[model samples]
Target chain A: MLGDALSLSLGYNATLVTLGATLLGAAAGMAGTFLYLRKNALISDAISHATLPGLGIAFLIAVAFGWDGRQLAILLGGSALSAALGLYFVNWLTRETRLTQDTAIGCILSVSFAFGVVLFTIIQVLPAGRKAGLESFLLGSTAGMLYSDALLILVLSIITALVLVVFLRPIKLVTFDASYSETLGISVRRVDFIILTLTLAVTVLGMKIVGLILIVALLIIPAVSARFWSEKTDIILITSTAFGALSGYIGSAISAVSAGLPTGPIIVLCAFGFFLISFLFAPKRGVLAVALKHYQFQKTVHLTQGLLSLALRQSIYEPKTRRLLQRFGYIRADGVVTEVGKSLAAKTLLNEKRWSYWQETLRESDQFDGQVVFSLMDIETKLTQDQILLIDQGLAARKGKKL
Target chain B: MMSGIALVSDKGVLLNAAADDRNAPFTIRGLTVSYGQVPAVYSIDFTAPAGSLIGILGPNGAGKSTLLKAAMGIVPVVSGQVSFFGKPLKEARYQVAYVPQRASVDWDFPATVYDVVLMGLYPILGLLRRVSKADKAKVAESLAKVGMQDFADRQIGQLSGGQQQRVFLARALTQRADVFLLDEPFSGVDAATETAIISVLKILQLEGKTVIAVHHDLSTVSTYFDHLFLLNRKAVAYGSVTKVFTKDNLVTAYGGKLGAAQLDAIGL
Candidate 1:
């Protein structure tokens, strides 16, 4: 697509558009980070849904004025109004009533969007000889974007980014602890207003490409993936923008060149791809990685448990007696031992795995050298195997208690 | 001054009746904090001498945390004057370090323990002064004092509750402030965490700092603090533990017949 766009001599415009889209996505990522942190991801979604009415109104004004007159101004103004109203209701429902934030967000989204649809329908009730260019604003289409839209998005994105940076420390402090931030001389009201205002500005600007219904995906997906990539504030912010930019470029190219595909879903899916990769491959917190770690941990524990049980057998058993005892339960007569038997392996393998299972109990007991100085009775006043293990694991069960 | 002292769980054990410094670090007149139409705190009065560990004690809704917040200038005081070293909080912003409640923040926020501790330098490093090597050293020193030097680079969310609390204390230490306001710092903490924070505060107190903490669980109030401020919608008592933390004062602070909440004993 880049090659084709380049060959046609429209390369510069294409690059500019991609750059503009990337900038838009970056602002979305930055704004979305706070939304994710504040547990207000759905707030953006609600704002997006509510902006549809603003679109129809802006279209009416644009048509009355002429398409070339002041479309950006009217569009931004309408979306901003819708977004503010959405925010007011979100705050009202969540604060004034006992309704959960999720419920409030959903109610605002559905009702406001339905209103937008009704307004669009009323305006076009008679098919008033004019094209329904206003309806196109509902789902968004890049066909209408020109260099002017790019410039507007750029200005809005810069302002939004600046806001995020200036209030970075306060925002960080509050996201970590709002009540404490209030205690430390920070105003929750001002911070919340800043966040919401930034969200509104970003939404109005991005409504060109992703439209009102799907701009939220552009806002939220990057931050959600960022959670999996880094645990540091600065890194999370940076990574969110980078990933967001990547999705923006990919979504734009696909929508522009593909035969048919909704740009909104494409951008969201691109972001979801990033999220999926992070969730699966992220070093420690990733879903599959954590699960794999757990599996390894459990396997080691079982090996250790088996070794310990073997140790409980008489020393007279030496090596063969242990194997004979093992054969009683795990060995196969076909001379091909079971997988568990193979997993148990030699003493070396069992010993290697032993720490996985035994670490917890021995840690509780504060035991070293396989020699537990404190007996279960001495440590916890009971002789249960679980208690002994807990004691060995150095947990509260036996931490301060005298054996 | 005692050797191998076990950290007091509440304001009671750590505060000695004699720990009061002749130089009081703060004074508040008619301090009040309100949330919109609701009054989280209404009219608080108190003074703390420098180098003293004071506990602000009350029941769940006694506005203990709110009082501390008002003093810190974090909570808006609908009407009142607070003086730190005889100046307003804005003039003395760098001199105050605030350690918030453990549960008030999102622990899963992407920040290293080191990065979090460095936030304490924000008042000093405000505007465009880059966080210098000196600031990094202070963060390390604070983390080390909290026995969290080894975990400095670890993500805050990955830590246990006690560790996260210590990290917050580390940040406070980096503020290098003359006073500290901790909201429910000891809540949900283990013995080690209690000890760690007490030790850090000791270093601060030795340097003649004033430590005011909003603490629940009244059992340890007498033992933990040199002074006590018992507040429930108003100033109930403010003075030395012996003078203001008496049995009668306990009843008064715990809303002794004021509000419906009775003094519930929780081991300090």
Candidate 2:
């Protein structure tokens, strides 16, 4: 199975596709770090969704111009234009009105997606008929990605990565604090536009592999997962890139072997698997690590409570457990407690009492009082002779009180 | 306090060198800023000379913070202009540093103290330039100034409130500018941090770097700042702290919420 998987990974038919996807994923991850920090993850979603209408329009224009509607360059150009327009609208709405970034993004995402759907339906009924697999752009079908298309993705991804690095300091400053950056003389709007344009390019290019709907997952998940592993920005960026590359490579390889699974979904699933692993297993920040810490804390508290009660009952501590309990300052090595410990023990004993049935522990009217009696057998095994005698007397006194 | 004196004050107190000094670190003229329908700061005018520790003080809604932001062009001014060193803000951008309110930033942002401090070098380095060895030294020196050199590699969010403020102060320090505008550097910080910040501000003043800070605590106002600007959607008073920090001005700024004795107790 390993050999077969390795063979599939290195296969001629899959190599370019995998490489392109991997690069795209890495770019998205790098760019997504800023977007994520800015709390504008949905902007990518809106832009990606908005590209669909452009694709439809581009295809229509191509057909009108008597050219091939499936031409990659024309379609992508249209996609970029419309996506940019969608982003502009979002920015305008947020600026010119009371609508927040989230509201603006939602409006653009839904409206643009609806327009694309309508256009898709309209195109299907035209003379071109079904638009020659243009529907694959919706969920992304990588099976037909030509070598040229793969090359385009690779070059775009590399350029995006290089640009991001070049402007890393300014972009980092702006993303973390746009207002502050502005005060420091960085044009927040220009930096913001740079980021938006880069995102637009990456999202449009990535649509060939992950589809409009799932490309955001590739951007967001890897960065988010990387967050679980590191707190430093450079570390996060590098880790996110690695995660994205791994997801793209592994996801593509899996989809290749299965033959039935869609590349986009498989890629997202692989990213999600990494996310789950990070969520559950990453040290310090992961769920398992946090839960383990919490569990140990609770166990310690539980044991301390038990030891306190047992000490109240005059049971001698086992040397090993006593040493542990002593480490917590709950008991002395010589086995005698001060007033503070006595008060704590008294409080613990009182906490176990039933306030609603106080009279039941007193003298009862009959031998069978219907009141439940707790067994001290567990406490007896751990108690010394003098302590056992005191317990026996205490039990007898309670039994003798029954009428 | 002076290299030379050119003074102007409505309150007749010499706060610092006057607008005639030509190198006044900040000059705001008839500046008004509004949020939608409501005005936050209205018709504010002041010229802070180089080497003055000025405090912007007001009640919660009095727009003390807004005045600083508006001056820095972080908040849009409805009217008027702010100049740095007798030049427009854009022209003298290299000489201005702004430390935003501690709460205004996302603390969990993926950056270390060193990363954030290095951001101060960006304005000088420009978009395509890289950090030089001197720039790195400046960052280290700034961190050392704030006593945070040991925590340069620690993530910003892991810092305590005071340490975070120190980190921001370090960022501003790295600017090596002639003017620094700090928004509530003392808020949520311990007394020690407050003292550290004030001492840093004093050092900046001695070095001829003008510092304007939005200060919330009125009690420490007299001690921390030599010059004071009290605001209540408008400029209530601006001059030397002893002259401007009067009970009547406090009443106007705080809308009679503070009693005269309370103001007196705060050493108004």
Candidate 3:
């Protein structure tokens, strides 16, 4: 069953929903990159939550006009209006009052959502609202999605992606440095507005698929995960979009094969799975990479210290160090140093002596390059052959004078 | 407690000439800016001639940065008129370049050193324009000027504080504007970076471009600036470094915060 769903053989309706969810995920990921870079990821939460009130009001108005209250277009339009209003309120409160952005977002998010819940309960008690299935929007259920709803999601996602592509450069510049963007004749306020609008579009489109509650995850997690992969803005953006689309596609397919599973939680879980993978295994910035780097550094330090001990004729007490030296054939089980061990030990000792001599004597004279860091890395990598020879001569002269 | 000789206000005489000269790089009249109800900078009048390096000096919270921000229209001015080359700032924006303080932006943003410098061409390229090979060459040239050519591919956050400052200088250089406004360019930079920056400013001045920087170190003032605008919310003195950087001006700007020995050290 799962294979059939994954292959998009689960009938026409299922395929449409899966494809729509994929596009929605991709759009969210792309738009969310700018929001994440701007350091305003939580603003999407306020915008999504605020859409609840608009959804409820739009339902009531539709029922009063004797039309289908769950018409996807009408409901999404209402939610978009409310989400934009919520965004405006967040900005207004932040700018006009002493409240910070987070504080303002919290205020609007709770108040608007609570008002929405009040309307939701009122609708729930009514006779016509009993079969409304509005509860599906909370966690998202594509079980009975209409053809037009799927088409709407697909169109909006494509439009969002196109708009982002056209404005990507300016959006990136503004996100990186707003003051500099303004100096360059780009309107910072307009760019900010465009970002907020894109964020709103993604949130509203995500309501029928990921639901309002988990939509913020779809918008933020992919971008955050992508940051672990690359340092370039364009690469991060593309990687995040792909991650989001993958999550949406797989999550919807899995949900289609199961009888009672909702698509929203599964989609969020898929995105978190991607986040977990990137967090643990991505290169450079990932957990595994960092741990590997630390381990390598530790091994180098232990080897250097072990060599120093052998040079000084001291006993090697650390078992790991002893095993490392033995594995490299630098030492024997009977605590005897080999010819290679002796040569390495002597070189290490000489390097240490030259380093100290340079630090204690020639350091303040400014004769050597100050950029060379003598610790951790090999001294030879940092200094020229002539410079190392000069340091060695200085070390020998100091030893002769001490003698 | 102000003890300076009462000199004639430089406002009225320069105001008419500033409008007519057309060569004056920057001219400001009655510039006032406030944050909330408190004023950051009061009404002030100043002008910078072409081919001169000018320093805006003041104590902490004395509106030194606020003055430059106001002139660039980054902050809303309560009442002021700022002109570049005898034209309003908007009309001559392409001819002006601004380098904000390094600490003002998040260094952890995912951008390469080359990418940040390439942003200098955004105004010229505008929207929907591709960066040509010449533009890339210009970015390389600017990076080479600041000794950061080798760091083009390095992430911006990977650089040291001095290297970061140099990257911003390189970005400003890429703009190739006629007038440069820098906010605390030398602060938190290494000695080498400071020397490099001052030399670049000197070269720009020699090339007949106007350079105005918000400077903190008083000891380097005489050597770094050809003209000084001593400010503490308002202009205290505005003229050549030898004439404006006197004991009275320091006392008024700092409000006796400078010890007599400290003033003597900088030869005030």
Angstrom error of the Cα, residue A70, model 1: value is 7.7
Per-residue lDDT of model 3, residues A336-402, tens digit only: 9999999998988877887877678655332232343454457787667987898989877878999
Candidate 2 regions with alpha-carbon error over 4 angstroms: A1-11, A296-403, B1-22, B127-133
Best by lDDT: 3
Candidate 2 per-residue lDDT over residues A145-185, each given as its tens digit: 78898889888878888888888888888889888899877
Candidate no. 3 TM-score: 0.91
CAPRI-wise, candidate 1 is: acceptable
Best by DockQ: 3
| DockQ-superior candidate, 1 or 3 | 3
Better of 1 and 3 by TM-score: 3
Q: What is the lDDT of residue B221 in candidate 2?
A: 85
Q: Using alpha carbons, what is the TM-score of model 2?
A: 0.83
Docking class of 3: acceptable
Best by TM-score: 3
User: What does DockQ give for each predicted structure?
Assistant: 0.29, 0.30, 0.45
Ordered from best to worst TM-score, the candidate numbers read 3, 2, 1
lDDT of 2 by residue, B16-70 (tens): 3343645566788888999998999888778886667889998888898888888
The Cα error of candidate 1 at residue B73, in Å, is: 3.7
lDDT by residue (tens digit), candidate 3, B1-268? 1111111124223332334444467888889999999999998888777777889999999999999988988888999888887788788888899999999899999999999999998888777799999999999999888777788998898887788888898888999998999999999987778888899999998887889999999999999997888999988888888778899888999987889998989876
Instruction: For model 2, state the Cα shift of residue A304 in Å.
Output: 9.2
iRMS values in order, in angstroms?
6.1, 16.4, 3.7
